[model samples]
Each structure stands twice: as structure tokens, then as C-alpha cells.
Target chain A: AQTVTQSQPEMSVQEAETVTLSCTYDTSESDYYLFWYKQPPSRQMILVIRQEAYKQQNATENRFSVNFQKAAKSFSLKISDSQLGDAAMYFCAYMEGGTSYGKLTFGQGTILTVHP
Target chain B: EPEVTQTPSHQVTQMGQEVILRCVPISNHLYFYWYRQILGQKVEFLVSFYNNEISEKSEIFDDQFSVERPDGSNFTLKIRSTKLEDSAMYFCASRAFFGANVLTFGAGSRLTVL
Candidate 1:
């Protein structure tokens, strides 16, 4: 079974600054996917960014990016130019390749507070 | 952009009562999934449905829980007998295909079991 771990339960970043949320996972499979999801107080889970295990290059989407270290089994999310809207509970998730398909195992989550 | 939608944004039910959460996944998507997050907890995968049958399920999805795509657009998760522990936010998601692994999630349905 694959397990994703987000060590930080709470994090805070000043507006317009950068923040990084750590994530690590245990998986024996060579092929897999890592993801970061954001849940605002509104309770909607939104995909922040995703990284494919096979891709050595990290994934970046606007202010959201991932530092994916496959060898270390680490996939961390970096939010640059953070804004107040970025305040939310961030979750790290993992999905094993093959027949398991779309099933995801998620971490407990890191609550991010973007201070103005 | 297309997005998944879920009905009954909030549901309150008594313990031992049946509850059904409904979702309408993105059109043209082939894979559908259900996930739940307890208060202040991680989002846990419940079940995945594809090709009109269950592709995968987690330990949390016990005999008391079942999923059905009764029609083309509606996917439903039914709890035969709800328990207080069953209270959580249920989210429905869908992906265009498996290789991409990009899932679009709907605004969750908050279920409160009394």
C-alpha cells in the first residue's frame, strides 16, 4: 500500500512571499503519480499541481510548483508569490499505476495561512 | 471548463438511516471516483467506477456502502445504514482517462449523521 505523509500540520506565509509544503510517500512501484490538492474554507477540493514519477523535471502551474525527488520519495509543493487566496488546507496524494487506476491515498493535510 | 457537480450540498440524517449522495461527473470522462474527508482529516478514497462497474474500492467501503451509476449522468453512493462516524464531506471526481491522472473534483456534499 502507498502512503503519503505531510509532516507539517500548519504553515503560515506572508502575502506575496513564497511557501513550501513538504510531502513524502512510500511506494515500491516505479510508475506512479503525486499530487497536491487545496481545500478552502468553502470545502471544495481543487487540484493544485501534479507530478509524474517518471518525469525527472518538476511540475509547475502558475504560482504552484512541485519539487519532485523520486529517489528520495519526496514531492513537495512550492507556492510562489503567495496570495491571501492561497490560504487553505493543502493535501498531498499518491496514486499507484496500473489496475488501481484513479484511487488516491492522501496525507492528513497542511493548513496554510497567508498573512496580509 | 467543465466541472463535476454534486447534489444536496449538505445532508443531515439520523443514525441507522439510509443516505444517498449524488454526483454528475464531467461529460466525456471515462473514470469516476468517490472520496470522503472526515472533519479535519485527510481525503480518503472510497471507490472508483469505470466501464459501468467498480474498478477499485478501499477498506472504508464496507458491505454497508454501495455505488451505482443508475443513469448516464448520475453517479450515486448509497449508505445502507449510516453511523455517526459516517459523517463527513463526500467528493465526486472524474478523469478524462487513466494515463493523465488529472482528476477534477466537485464541491463536496457535507453529510452530518445525528
Candidate 2:
């Protein structure tokens, strides 16, 4: 079974500071995709960033980015210039790139709190 | 700027009763999915559908759970007999054929089985 692990249960950052949320996964498949999703109190899950396993370059989307260490099987999300709106339950998810389409294995999630 | 939409933002049902959660995925999307998040737990994948057939399902999806695309526009999940453990925030998601990794999720339907 594939499993994603987010070690921190909760994290907090002052407004304008940067924070990194750690994630690691165990999978036999060589090719896959890693994702970071943010769920606000509204319960809507929004995509933050995504990284393809084969890519040596990490993925970055505006304020969000990922440090993907394929060797370590670690994919961590970094939120830069954090704003109050970034406060939410952040989840790290993994999806197979080849067959077994679209099923995402997710971590237990890290609740992010942004202080004003 | 299309997004997946789900109905009945919240539903409360008695144990052993039936419940149906409805979703309307973004038009033109070829893949659909259902996921659930129990409070204080990880979000779990329930099922995935494509081309009128199930593509994948998690262990959490079993005989008691069924999915259907009754019409071209609507996808629904039916729980044969609800259990208290079934209570969770159920999310419907859809993805474009090309970018399968990017799934657009609905606001979600919170199901509470008492």
C-alpha cells in the first residue's frame, strides 16, 4: 500500500514570514506526481502546487512551491510571503503517473495557522 | 473558470437509512472522483470514474457504496445503509484529460449519520 506522511500536526507563521510543511511517501512505482492542497475552514480543497516525479526541478506556483527530493521520497510544501488567507489544513497527496489513474493517496494533513 | 459543484452542502441522516450525494463535475472533464475527510483525519479516496466505468476504488469504497453518472452532467454516490462511521465531508472532484494531476474539487457535502 502507498502511504503519504506529514509529520507535523500543526504549524504557525507570522504574517509575511515563510513556512515549510514536510511530507514523505512510500511507493514502489517509479513515476508519480506529488501535490499540495489547501483546505480552508470552508472545507473546499484547493490545489496549491504540483511536482512531477521525473522532474529534477521543483514546482512553484506563485506563493507556493515544493521541495521534491526523489532520492529521499520527500515532498515538502513551502509557503512564501504567507498571508492570513493561507491559514488552512494543508495536505500532501500522491498520484500515480502511469496506470491506476487519478487515485490520490493523502497524508494526515498539517493545520497551518497564520498570525496577524 | 469552471469548478466542480456538489449539492446539499450538508446532510444529516439516521443510521441504517439511505443517502445520496450529488455532484456536477466541470463540463468536458473526462475523469471524476469522490473523496472523504473525517474530522481530524486524512482525506481518503473513495472512487474514480471515467468513460462510464469505474477506473479505481479505495478499500474505503465497498459493497455499501455505489456511484453512477445517471445523466451526462450529474454524478452521484449512494450509500446503501449509512453508518455513523460514514459521516464525513464528502468531496467530488474532476480532472481534465490532459492534466489528470490537477483535480478541481467541489465545496463538498458534509454528511452526518446519527
Candidate 3:
């Protein structure tokens, strides 16, 4: 079984600044996918970004990016030029490659607060 | 972009009662899934359906729980006898046929068992 861990319980970042949320996972499989999802106060889960284990280059979506270290089993999310809307509960997820299609194991989650 | 939609945004029921949560996945999506998040807990996968049958299910999906795609667009999760522990937010998600597809989730239906 694969387990994702988000060590940071709560994080705060000033508007227009950058912040990073840490994530680590345990998986023996060589091929897998990692994702970061954001759940706002409304409780709607939204995809932030995703990274493929085979890719060496980190994935970036607008202001959201990830620092993926496969060897260390670490995948951290970085939000640049953060805005007030970035405040939410962020979750790190892991999915193993193979017959499994959409089964994602998620972390406990990190609450992000954007300060103006 | 098309998104998944769930009906009965909130449902209140008594223990031992039967409840069905309905969802309409994205039109073009081929894979559908159901997940639940207990208050203050991480979302947990319940079951995954593809090609009109269950492809995978978690231990949490016991005999009391079942999933069905009664029609082309509608996907449903039925609980035969609800319990207090069943109270949680149930989410319906869908993904396209392409490999390594990302899931699109609905707003979720909050189920409260009294």
C-alpha cells in the first residue's frame, strides 16, 4: 500500500510571496503519478498540478509548481505570487501505475492561508 | 469544461434507512468513481466503476454498500442500511478514457444519519 504524508499541518504566506508545502510518499513501484489537490472552504476538491515519476523536470501550472525528488520519495508544491484565493486545504496524492486507473491515496492535507 | 454533478446536495436520514446518492458524470468520461470524506478526515476511495461494472473497491465498501450505473449518464451509490458512521460527504468523480487521466470531482453530497 502506498501512503502520502504532508508533514505541515498549517502554512501561511503573504500576498505576492512564495510558499512551499512539503509532501512525501512510500511506494515500491517504479512508475507512479503524484498530484496536488486544493480544497477550498466550500469543500470542492480541485486539481492544482501533477507530476509523472519518469519525468525529471518538475511540473508547473501558472503559479503552482512541484519539486519532485523521486529518490527521496518527496514531492513538494510551490506556489509563487500567491493570492488570497490560494488559501485552502492542500492534499498530496499518489497513484501507482498499472491496471489501476483512478485510485489515489491522499495525505492528511495542509491548510494554506494567504495573508494580505 | 464539463463537470460532474451530484444531486441532493444534502440528505438527512435515520439509521437503518436506505439512501441512494446520485451523480451525473462528465458526458465524455468513461471512468467513474465514488469517494467519501468524513468530517476533518482525508478523502477515501470507496469504489471505481468502468464499462458498467465495478473495477475496483476498497475494504470500506462493505456488503452494505453498492454502486450501479443504471443508465448511460447516471451513476448511483446505494447504502442498504445506513449507520451513524455513514454520515459524511460523498463525492463523485469522473475521468476520460486516456491513460493517466486526471479525475474531475463534483461538489459532493453531504449525508447526515440521525
Candidate 4:
């Protein structure tokens, strides 16, 4: 019933530069959660950051942050001071709130390449 | 930090054969989930288990698929008959409880069906 879309299939950035990955979703639920996950070459899905729909303030975790626009149903991730290790497949995921199970709907991941 | 562990990093099997993937969720976690991703595709939810029973499942989890917590620490996903299309990386995830939203995921088991 819910769908997440990552318009960009691939992205590249130079080391120490900043990059933003765009994500949008179609959902009818009012309360939900959003997350950004990074899968490096090792194929381990690591949580980058998270944001709650109820909170307008964006979430920031060290070098990873999110621009969450609840009304627009858009949540984008920003990586600052990108390192080569940041190169990975980035995924935007969504989950409904209010007594619902943590079933995640993920977007078509964007492959990020950070140059040294 | 506590992490979810999955076995058989990679497995190759023939069509119509049975395959079982195993995972060990975090000890303190109460919720467990199985998700899969075909090569170059987004991750898709397969099933969620809680209290030793499946709480929810997706359309992708058909009769051929089954999940079990045979012991206190291990959760397993069994495919009765593997198909070529079933080839994918299967991930096991767990969360602390109902109010905890973040689901920690394992490295995933890559299954190749020939």
C-alpha cells in the first residue's frame, strides 16, 4: 500500500565533498518513520539515520543527516565530508506508525560512489 | 554492539531443491524479520516473527516459504522448492520491542538457484 521512490539510480562525489540523495514516497498514513541505510561492498546494511513524521526537525547522525518534509512526503539524505568508505548502495526506507509492525518499504536504492 | 547473525554467507542450489537459511537475532530483541533483495533491486519484506509465531507476511511469502524459531536463539527461513527467481540475498533483522523502531540487520545470505 505504501511505496518509496529514489529517483536517482546512481550518484558520485569526490572525497570530502557533500552529496544529497533524493527520496519520495506515497503513503496515506499520518504517522510513520523514515530511515536511510547504507550497504557497503561488504553488503552489510548499516543504519545511517532516522526521522519521525511527527517531528518536523530533521535527524542528524554525525556526517549523515536527513531533510524530511512530511507534507511533501519527501525524505532525502545528506552526506557531508564524504569519505571513500561512504561509497555504497543507499536505500530510503519507510515504516508506518501506531501499533503497526516494523515492516519496511524500501526504495530502489541509489548507488553512491565516492572518489578519493 | 549486539548484532544479528546469519549463516551460510553464500549458497548455490539446484531448482526444486530445498534451502534453509539461518539467523541468530539479538538476545534481548523481541521482534524478528526476513527480507530479500534480488540483484540490483530494492529490499522487500518477506515475513515478521514475534512470540515464536509469524505476526505478518508479505505476498512474496507464499506456501513454498516457511519460517521457524526452532530454538531460543535461532530463526530459520525454509524454502520448500527453490526457483530461479528465488535467487537473492536474504537478510535477517531484529528490533528491541514494539516501541523500538530501528531494526538491526545481518549481513545477509546470498542464495543462488541454478
* TM-score per candidate: 0.98, 0.97, 0.98, 0.98
DockQ of each: 0.90, 0.87, 0.84, 0.87
- Mark the regions of model 4 whose C-alpha exceeds 4 Å error after superposition: none
Worst 10 residues of 4 chain A by lDDT: A94-103
Better of 1 and 3 by lDDT: 3
Query: What digit string (tens of lDDT, one per residue) describes model 3 on residues B1-114?
Result: 799999889999999999999999999899999999999999999999999999999999999999999989999999999999999999999998859459999999999999
What DockQ number belongs to candidate 2?
Answer: 0.87
Which candidate would rank higher by DockQ, 2 or 3? Answer: 2
Residues B1-114 of candidate 2: C-alpha lDDT, one tens digit per residue = 898999999999999999999999999999999999998888999999998999889889999999999999999999999999999999999988955678999999999999
Per model, state how many residue pairs clash.
0, 0, 0, 0
A1-116: candidate 1 lDDT, tens digit per residue: 88899999999999999999999999999989999999999989888888888898999999999999898999999999999999999999998887886788999999999999
Query: What's the TM-score of chain A alone for every prediction?
Result: 0.98, 0.97, 0.98, 0.97
Q: TM-score of each model's B chain?
A: 0.98, 0.97, 0.98, 0.99
Local accuracy of candidate 1 as per-residue lDDT tens digits, B7-77: 89999999999999999999889999999999988999999999899988889999999999999999999
Report candidate 4's fraction of native contacts.
Answer: 0.88
Candidate 2 lDDT, A47-115, residue by residue in tens: 888888989999999988889999899999999999999999999999987776588889999999999
Worst 10 residues of 1 chain B by lDDT: B95-104
In the order shown, the candidates' Cα RMSDs to the true structure are 0.9, 1.0, 0.8, 0.8
